[model samples]
Target: MIDWLNSTALTVFGVGTTWAEVLGFVTGLLNVWLLIRQHVLNWPLGILNVLLLMVVFGTAGLYADMGLQVVYVILGLYGWWAWLYGGAGRSELVVRTTTRAEWLGLAVAGVLLTGGLWLFLDRMTGSTVPLADALTTALSLLATYGQTRKLVESWWLWIAGDLIYIPLYGYKDLWLTAILYVAFLTLCVLGLRAWRKAIG
Candidate 1:
């Protein structure tokens, strides 16, 4: 039984999938688990997950995603510091709702950024599903920034991005990643509820 189970594990994490992505998914799960509890340690673990993803995306030639990993690194650092010293008296950041103007800005920015990235990828790079990919990618960036600031609206953006991302990753032949995004979608919903309750 042990041998058989080991073989199955090997096959699942075999030739197509690398150890880095597996580790990445594990760290991502851990990060989210901590995040749900509003733990500061989540930021560091999240950074580790992004680092692993950076390697995975680079190997897959998903340039936009690979580049996003770099951005994640910077954001992770900022988030770490901000969460540590971005509240009253420079304390931990807390959840906040988007103001009317912020909502308008996020909507307009999400659309404009998505359109711009689509054009850039479609015209400049030989990207498959360039428009769809770019749109999700751009919005995810906005979402990530929002999350760092502990904004409740980040959950909504994540939901939208992950909804599109699951299919995109699947279409890209990244089966494991597609699965990860599915989990992310669920967590986004949970995070929203959790943050709302905390804020209220």
Candidate 2:
């Protein structure tokens, strides 16, 4: 299965897109689509998407991104339960805005964590795009945490990360994944709009 998934799916603009990228693209789209509608199933779907992308990123030497997929799985589990029960009286979670304190803490954590990961990826790994990768990773972590809490601001963080990710994936010659991030950018915008309304 691993070998098959790593094999070329098609050649597009001289880039040999892999089956893993193709499958990840589909699951990733559905995962985000479901999340926008506040569905619990997005968690399992997202886990699958990240696992496939782990292979893609590992091949591309995007170590931070490959590692990010591992963390996403952990966060996905928490998010799954959060959506189902992390609410008043262990009920379903609802959309909410981040408090000022939460915003400040997330900002600080993003900066600090990005620095730490960037340093590690720079010195401890062969990651040429460590800073870019680390920045996106931090943003993704913040976004995922906020999303798990049903925070409306999570989509904004995803938007920021997607902006960087599109070009990064393109630079890595992962054309399909670049396109996936473009789709993610669009979905993040729509999700933000939808969640804003859901806050009421």
List, in order, the clash count of every candidate structure: 0, 0
Q: Candidate 2: lDDT of 185?
A: 100
Question: What is the alpha-carbon lDDT for the whole of candidate 2?
Answer: 0.95
Superposed by TM-score, candidate 2 places the C-alpha of residue 120 at a distance from the truth, in angstroms, of: 0.6
Model 1: per-residue lDDT, tens digit, 1-200? 22221221222323466677677778988888787778989888988898887777766667778788888889988988998999999988889998888888888888888888888888888777778777887887899888888989888988999999888877776677788989988988899899999998
- What TM-score do all the candidates reach, one by one? 0.89, 0.98
Candidate 2, 7-77: lDDT as tens digits = 99998679999999999999999999999999899999999999999999999999999999999999999
Q: Among all windows of ten consecutive residues in candidate 1, which has the lowest summed lDDT?
A: 2-11
Off by over 4 Å in 1: 1-15
* Model 2 regions lying over 4 Å from their true place: none
Cα error, candidate 1, residue 68 (Å):
0.7
